[model samples]
Target: MNTCLRPVAEQDAAALFTLVDTHRAALASWLPWVAATHTQQDSLAFLQHSVAARQQGSQYDWLILVDGQLAGVCGLHSVSAANRRACVGYWLAPPYVGRGVMQAALQQLCGQAFGPLGLQRLVIDPALANVRSIAVAQRAGFGFEGILRQHLWLHGQPHDAASYSLLATEWAVRQPVQA
Candidate 1:
C-alpha cells in the first residue's frame, strides 16, 4: 500500500469532491458531512476551512494519496495545545477500504502528532457500529477506553461511540529500537 498523507490544498477540491461523491452512500452512513457536500463548491469551502484551521493552529487535515491518486482524507481535529491532545478522524473511498491504506496514513499522522507536534495524547472516537474504524484504532495500538454513550450526533440522531487513546509514552514504547 503505497500511501501517503499530505496537507489538503485548494487545488485538490475537485479531486476530493470526486472521491467523496464516488463513495457517497458508504460514507453517508457514518459521516454527516458526506450528505451535505453536494458539489465541488462545497468541497472547496471545506478545504478552505481546513486551511484556515491549520493557519490558526487548531487542526491539521490531510489528503490520503495512494499511488499518487486521492484515496481518502484523515486528520487531527480539535487540537488543544494547552491540553496537549487532539482527536483523530478519517475516511476512505470505498475502493480503498480493507487495503491497509488508512492504517498507514493514520500511523504516519500518529508519528507527527507525538513527535514534532509534542502532543501528549491522541484520541480516536468511532461510532460503536463502525467496526472497521475500531479495528484500525486497535491495530494502531490505541487502547480502548469505553463506550461514549450518545457521544455523536449524526444525521440528527444520537449514536454511541467507542473512545480509544494512545499516549506519547505508549507510542514511545511501541517504537522500534535503532541499532
Candidate 2:
C-alpha cells in the first residue's frame, strides 16, 4: 500500500473523531484520553492543541493515509529539545491493522526524527500487555530497553509498560547507503 503521513489540519477533525468513536472501546482500553473524546469538538480541540504544540516546537502529529484514505494517526510527543529525544505514538483503524501501514509510517517518522528534526533518540512505550504495539516498535528497529512499572494509567488503573528506544546511530546503520 502507498502509505503517507500528512500533517494534521483543522479540517480533519471529523475524520479523526469518526475513527476514534468507531474504535472507542479498543482505543479507550489503552489511551486514557479516548474516553474524553466524545465528539468532533474534542478532536478539533486536540488538533488545535497539536497545531499550537507544533508551532511551539513541543509536539508534532500527523494523519496516516493509506492508499489515499485516512487510516490512522501517528505522532511524536513528549519532546525534549535539550535532550534531543522524543516518544512515538501511533494507532491504526481496524481495517488498516496487520497490513504494515503503521510500520511504514513509523519508518518515515523515524527518518524525519533522525534527519531534519536533528533528534538523537526516539522511544516507544507500549503497555506490556499491548503485544501488537510492541511488535510495531520492534519492526521499526527499536530495541527493548526495560519495563517501567506503572508507566501508564489507563481506564483508571496503572499499567506497566515496555520501553523501547532507537538512537540516531542505530537508525543510520539500518538505512541504505546513498549511492
C-alpha local distance difference test of each model: 0.93, 0.92
Q: State the lDDT of candidate 1 residue by residue for 67-102, as single tens digits.
A: 999999999999999999999999998899899998
For all predictions, the C-alpha RMSD in Å is 0.9, 0.8
Clashes of 2: 0
Over 4 Å off, model 1: none
Give per-candidate clash totals. Answer: 0, 0
Tell me the tens digit of each residue's lDDT in model 2 across 84-119.
Answer: 999999988888989989988998999888988899
For candidate 2, the 10 contiguous residues with the lowest summed lDDT are 23-32
Which residue ranges in model 2 land beyond 4 Å of their true spot?
none
Pairs that clash in candidate 2: none
Residue 104 in candidate 1 has what lDDT?
92
